[model samples]
Target: MNTSPSVPGAGRRTDGSSVRIGALVPLTRPGWVEAGRHLLAGLELAVRDVNDAGGITGRPLELVVRDTAADPRRAAAAVDELAGLGVAALAGEYHSVVARAAAARADALGLPFLCSSAVLDALTEQPTGRVARLAPAQSHGWRIYADFLLGAGHRRIAVAAEPSVYWAAGARILRDHLAPRGGGVTELDMRSLDPGAVCDELADKRATALLLLVGHPEPAVSVVKAVRRDRRLAGIMIGAPAGQPEFAEWAALLGGDGTAVPFLRYLPERLGPLGARVGAALRERLAEAPSFVAYEGYDTVAVLAEVLRSHGPDRARIAGSWPQVAVEGTRGPIRFSRTPGIGVWQWAWPPVQVVDRDPAEPARFRVLHTG
Candidate 1:
């Protein structure tokens, strides 16, 4: 069957020895490489575990990985290539916009895709059974974040957002959820302004909470620094619902400044038995405590393996099997169904938490609220 490939995202074996699962991840620049690394690690670990436990119907389960690099066109192209390469099904992607493009392409081609981590509510333009997602939808998780903002006694919210469909969708979710409760969202265009300007606007608007819908490292880091150092916005709470601060790079760059900024994470307060075992294994593999995205990666494979066992690798069979999937994922029981507003089959939700790094212990995450 499948021999575990030494290098992730490398070409798959063409000898017809393995049952292939096409993986799309951001492995290079502009792709949030750290997150991608964790995602790949979990996928690889699960693939190895699957093969060890007797690969699907006796064929080694192989992951034919492709780097989407946070680009939609690149992801679409990868889907086509993977489809042509004879992969049985598809999995993995971090960025919501890139995942949407990949999902659209896969659905059009009649390929089965179990998305690991992208949470945008509208994964496809129309309802389709070919694609399913494990992460909570953007509307579901982000509205919870908006509720957290309101709960923390912050009503006047300002969003420092970059120009992106994903960011725009997040802004809409926050706005729509908050407005009914006497809350409002003010959007600051990051296109024309710098970090100093962002701080100045937060002060002028008297907004108590500034949610960062911007990119990581550059402008987001800069804005956090400016606001943290500025006396005028001393009482302002910095937030990142997009979860830029989840990775080590954010902490390395900003350190304590990055701590205590709430972000959406898909996990419960405590890991169950399966989750605990998986987390320990992932921690050993990664040499660091795994992020929740890593668990999503593992759970993606867990569900797919069960599907492939029950329904063969045929695309139509796999596509039709989302409703039948019932696997014990790392986080919880994994299953899929049509959600109210979501276009594709969706995991009604995984555990959603608004968490922040403990300022007292920068290495530890503290759960602020659970939704």
Candidate 2:
């Protein structure tokens, strides 16, 4: 673990007082912990790198992290603690619901939050300069996926997954994106049907493709299994933005032909040394590859670090500096504009088929789609 010397006060605190920086990460649950570790690793590396290079304004950055467990209630409390500690800035995780809670807390406290990875579109909207996102919004991802499906000549699409608030929002965004193109949307609620019933319904659907908008791994996998039981649904290509490596295991268990996940293809891969380091460290620590959530965490930190460098450690400065920070993120450049969400920083991740599973690199599954 890299530690930085104390930060001084005011523009340039020659007094040699250190700034207390806080972060929120889910360290409790096994799944969230696994992802959190990768994010933490990335953040740690960035801190180390910055400190080694003589931190901002000759004052080193400090980090204090909390476990949010991806739970909203926990996340709210976590933010409250961080704010009370008087941190210079904050970042963490990929779940939007948690970010929403954290945003509310940050707003009440007048602190700048450099959202690490939560994509929920609402989290980005802070009446005050308290909350800002680092990645493409969740709604943006859904819209992009919907547009891609429409472009692929898939007008009729079936949606199936665990009933979650995120999925609902994603579905609405998908509908909006498809509406302009006259695409039809139908939902196959996994909660309402049994495994066998789901198979029959999906097999009978006239939809051209399947969109899995679920959150948890279990429900998403179950829906896929059901979709595959019937060979008649062979031609329908399946897609998921919240892809997991376990997805391959589920597909293999169900013997499904259609299984794919949408992910942003990072260019010059080494450009994100922080991300690469975090992923590598996580693999070594957990004995498994990091998940998408892990990548979200690393990306969030990278964006925050860039903003801090140019804008200084002030919360207001950080908020004001976003427009100036040109970040080449894991997905693409994240540039927020005057139109709230309408900006070039937005990304369109393409769907990729999970052709084969590699146990040696569980998190490094082979993607069918490439540049």
Candidate 3:
């Protein structure tokens, strides 16, 4: 098949009109599309800001977006197409499984992928220089969450989990971190249990805390409702370490029941100057308060735009440039390093916090813990 010369990847662009970065986001059903919208909001905002001042080397920095829809196979294929289209680098992916697939393909294709979100620690089987991540790995964030559970005096924990690698990995991280500290995790497989069954199991086990390791608005919402209604489980605390409560839909669906269910969030107690400014811009663009995923998206382009400015649009140069990255991001000074157990070039961490919607004012988030 003959390729079109008008495509960005075509060799015909010797004039250097623009530098393109491929964006992988889930914008449709089955994917957490609200998160994608926020992520895209941050990415688009950064690109606009970059171009407003000046694009990389006077060429407009362009974003070629493709929907991953939270599918691994689709994400891999998008990586191939984006690579073939001559994207200088890749960014965005909220789902860890999808990001893992895209990262693996980008590594093999020599494409620099700065993953915006997706906390699975084992993002790739083998380490490679091409893929770097901005989110805290599952182990790091989940361990903090486990510590929060311990701090709250909840030693016996139960996780209502689904059959997913991401879920299983999260469970493992919680277990590993909590076991040495006298905390035990009980896994209630959501596949076999309904909302009532989960409540029954929680009551039977006498678990003090029920960590939601399942997806949102489905078993998670139902389970929360069941537990909230059951008199036996009224004293039990609920948590969502995977950040299901971070989005507005969770509160919109579960309302009062969703409040106080502490979830992991990747922002500092206070936004730095840049973070505050960007947060305002993102709020304007998104027409609502932006999620951490949005800030992640902005930081991604911030880091990449700097790399492209200093290093040009070469994929290898961008990958090689990861170690030297030092950009003032929305959250804090963003840098990359090899973190223990994490395979990609990681940002070490963004500020991790256990926050929840205040039951008194569901629109407001109250910080429960931080690290």
Index of the highest-lDDT prediction? 1
**TM-scores of the candidates in the order shown:** 0.96, 0.76, 0.95
lDDT of 1: 0.90
Q: Model 1, 51: alpha-carbon shift in Å? A: 0.8
Q: Higher-lDDT candidate among 2 and 3? A: 3
C-alpha RMSD in Å of predicted model 3 compared with the true structure = 3.8
Per-residue lDDT over 92-206 for candidate 2, one digit per residue giving the tens place of the 0 to 100 score? 7657677778777777777777766666666644455556665556665556556567666888887775666777888888877887889977887877876677667666777
TM-score, structure 2 vs. true? 0.76
Model 2 weakest 10-residue run by lDDT: 1-10
> What is the C-alpha lDDT profile of model 1 across 1-371, one tens digit per residue?
11225423323322246788999989888988899999988899888778777777777788988998899999999999999999899999999999999999999999999999999888899899899999999999998998899899999999999998899999999999999999999999999989999988999999999999998777899999999999999899999998888888999999999999999999989889989999999999999989988998999988898998899889999999999888888888988988899989899889999999999998999999999
Clashing pairs in 2: 7-17, 7-18, 9-13, 335-345
Estimate every model's Cα lDDT from 0 to 1.
0.90, 0.60, 0.89
Candidate 3 per-residue C-alpha lDDT over 158-272 given as tens digits, one digit per residue, 9 for 90 to 100: 9999999999999998999999999999999988999999999999999999999887668788899999999999899999988889898998999999999999999999997
Ranking by TM-score: 1, 3, 2
Candidate 3 Cα outliers beyond 4 Å, as residue runs: 1-16
CA error at residue 139 for candidate 2, angstroms? 3.0
The alpha-carbon deviation from the true structure for residue 107 of candidate 3, after best TM-score superposition, in angstroms, is 0.8
